[model samples]
Target: MPFAHAVMHEENGVFGISFPDFPGCTTGADSEEEAIRKADEVLTFHVAGMLEDGEVLPVRRSLKELLSDPEAKEGLAKGVLFLARYELPRKSVRINISMDETLIEAIDRAAEHANQSRSGFLADAARQRIRDLLKAE
Candidate 1:
């Protein structure tokens, strides 16, 4: 299944890569080929963590619909195409938690390394922990 999203643009001498659906997910390279190569690595970890959590994947919007929206022009320019076959809807829930500063900092570092925002990282961590708990039961 398709497991990642990427958008690219040429600015100055470098190609900037960004993942639209994934906040804080970004990587850049000197060329299109190099950027795509790096994107593969970034996507692997992002999808792996999701798989571990049994989390559903993101849906791919239709090209027609996307194109109709002016906002989507930028994504189209960057070659952002969603493969419909890989689309999977996700379920969301709200929760509250309290943790130590050290732990929070660690999570933040982990999130940065994974190219995800703090919220995404915490959600992934929580999901994985819950999955492990269920498996152990």
Candidate 2:
């Protein structure tokens, strides 16, 4: 996983978020909290798309590095900064684990309801939990 600096600007009650390192990658929300949350999703998907297309991911810039750029300076003047987590998807590997039968049954039901394989459902749930934990910090 990598972290990118996300710039957040607000206009007309809507908060807009963008990543300087990843051009054309952006998202927005109705509040600051929502903007932060959406930034994570947008950054992750944007990087994932880039990877899928065989595009090279840029090396993330430090806050100092970003502040040195004139364009970044101007954007910062109008907004604020935060780090958005970027987890690159990798090749899947098979694994085996033991769990309570009832828990496994419930997971299967939830996966079916969501139209996702059990592996996908578990992966998404884990990612969301990681994001929530990171936000709490």
Candidate 3:
């Protein structure tokens, strides 16, 4: 299990939560409680997406250090702050999808050449696409 820090900034009745360790990882809600709950799911998805994209996980700063930061401390004054924990999934489930036969063969060959399972190869491709899409925004 790994842990991450989250800071919630309240604005106009909305709670916007963000992770200092992960610059782009964030979620929000109307209440502090909902913001915390959303942070858990966002953290889980973010860590898994990073892993899938073959990106390095960031080393988390201690709570004391996070609290010491100017921006984080500013967030403290503006609203609330907290920590969220996430664990990688212990098991994987098989899935099915329909595709063109030619594409399927190409994907299978690429997976074999990459020394990866078909699922793993496809997962990596999807994650990379997501990264590209986000970066273009």
Candidate 4:
């Protein structure tokens, strides 16, 4: 997991988020909670697109370092700062595992309903679980 610094500002009751390290990557919502959630999603997809396009990801900068930059400083002055977690795309590898027969059937049914392969469904479930656990911390 990698975290990006996000600045959230509210205007006319709508919340907007921006990543200084990733210029042009922005998202918004009607509430703070939604803004935070959207920030993570936006950053994750933005980074993935960059990786697909052979663009080098920017270095993660600390709050102190960001403050030294005028643009980031200005954004920080008008908004709240938080870390948005993003996952880097990786090459797929096959693995062998065993699980209860009933559980496997249930997973297959759900995956079919969601129109996703078993691996994709399982990966998404695992990621959501990890995010929930992190939020609990």
Which predicted model would earn the best TM-score? 4
lDDT of 4: 0.87
Q: Write the per-residue lDDT of candidate 2 for residues 12-120, one digit (tens) a residue.
A: 9988998888888888778899888878877887787687569999998877888899988888889888888977888888889899999999999999999999998
Better of 3 and 4 by lDDT: 4
The top-ranked prediction according to lDDT is 4
What tens-digit string does per-residue lDDT give for candidate 3 at 7-39?
Answer: 788889987888888888888778788778777
Clashing pairs for model 3 are none
lDDT of 2: 0.84
lDDT (C-alpha) at residue 1 in model 3:
73
- TM for every model, in the order presented, reads 0.47, 0.65, 0.64, 0.66
- After superposition, candidate 3 runs with Cα above 4 Å error: 95-137
Could you give the C-alpha RMSD of every candidate to the true structure, in order shown?
Answer: 12.1, 7.1, 4.7, 7.5
Order the candidate numbers by TM-score, best to worst.
4, 2, 3, 1
Arrange candidates, best lDDT first. 4, 2, 3, 1
TM-score of 2: 0.65
Encode model 4's per-residue lDDT on 58-103: one tens digit a residue: 9989888999999999999999989999989888889999999999
TM-score of structure candidate 4: 0.66
Q: Higher lDDT: candidate 2 or 4?
A: 4
lDDT of each model, Cα atoms only? Answer: 0.63, 0.84, 0.80, 0.87
Looking at model 1, residue 67 earns an lDDT score of: 67
